[model samples]
Target: TGTICTRTALLDSRATGMFMDLAFARENGLDVQLLTHPIFYNVDGTLNEMGSVCKEVEVILWIDDHSKQVVFSMIRLGKTKLIIGHTWLHHHNLEINWTTGKLTLTQCLSDC
Candidate 1:
């Protein structure tokens, strides 16, 4: 619902969807859209019965000179504030240089 001001985001290729810390989303005054059918899971291949995902929020990502809007499902994770996962990587066709620790855009959207 509102712009996210956070700059730090972890790029996780193994993750299936973009995730945002629930507390962080609230502190930033972002609107949380409740999901009708919530899905839950953990990295350990175990069912996360604690209602892992029930809401989602939209935010804008500014990369280089281009700006793109993205949606992230809310989760209660302690490791990082935000996580850009497979959904974003595939949608934007981003390339990550592990050695240099840099991200490169492989394809440009119409807005870019």
Candidate 2:
């Protein structure tokens, strides 16, 4: 779904899954897929105040020369429009230069 393209995302080591802001997705015309079961936990295992995540959207994410299709749970994010969480980080084993704010894909699995 070429609904939206964004350059900014929060790379959080603690987040369990990738996520997209519900409002942002709607505002940008991203297609939302409803989940049969909703999620209620946050990165810290606390109750999600914004409510259950009952929808998701699949989008292609581009980072430099690499691009991958990702499914993101739609939720209400306080400060960010998207989050690239632990599941994605672990799979890609990405290198992040915090000082320079750059990301590099050191090694990639064939499937990705």
Candidate 3:
């Protein structure tokens, strides 16, 4: 249970779930849990033999004065660290401004 204090995150609307770098998770000393089922995907949608995903971790997302805890599945993404995907965005009712490259939390649910 480690708190993510980094502001640098990529907002990917096309991504279905949150993802974190395996190396980063290890460096942060985050507790990674094994998934019952493995997730497989490539950046180009081509099949690659990267084995199964056996790790996941919960991270705290801090934005401005608001904060939220989110679970991220660990993967080996080259050069990319944190990626906030559609699931998290929709769950939090977040609005993204493409023009200004800004993210706004439209509504806060009770859980959030």
Candidate 4:
């Protein structure tokens, strides 16, 4: 099942607004649809905001701003095995002790 979630915070009116005025809108018959889906338009398509609507997400597919409170909860419960799907600024702030090798590693999700 494929899904889409747009994070409204990242919207840029300048760059996107100019793109919307281009001729390809009517030529390709896609302007109206793309107008509403800006996050996928500018950057590499791989980084779209596809998690905003999920309620009970498994393996968070961690991104730029994981809340510190959620991470503290994970630490309080002693989750020893954490798979970081992607690294960003927030990933380094997770506060788990790794120098002592308290955590264990497993294969990446594609292999699992």
Give RMSD to native, each candidate.
Answer: 2.9, 1.8, 3.1, 17.8
Any idea what lDDT model 2 has? 0.87
| Candidate 4, residue 94: lDDT | 32
All models: lDDT?
A: 0.79, 0.87, 0.77, 0.25
Candidate 3 — number of clashing residue pairs?
0
Instruction: Candidate 3: list runs displaced more than 4 Å.
Output: 1-4, 41-51, 97-100
After superposition, the stretches of candidate 4 with alpha carbons farther than 4 Å from their true spots are 1-43, 47-53, 57-68, 71-82, 85-99, 103-112
For model 2, the stretches where C-alpha displacement exceeds 4 angstroms are 42-46
Clashing residue pairs in candidate 1, if any? none
TM-score of each: 0.77, 0.88, 0.75, 0.16
- Could you say which candidate leads in lDDT? 2
Ranking of all candidate structures by their lDDT, best first:
2, 1, 3, 4
lDDT per residue for candidate 3 within 56-85, as digits (tens), equals: 888677886678777898887768888888
How much is the lDDT of residue 52 in candidate 2?
89
Worst 10-residue lDDT window for candidate 2 reads: 1-10
Per-residue accuracy of model 1 over 4-23 as CA lDDT, tens digit each:
48467888889877888898
lDDT of 2 by residue, 1-112 (tens): 5555665899998887898889888888888999999888765789998898999998888888888988999988977989988889999998889899999987978887
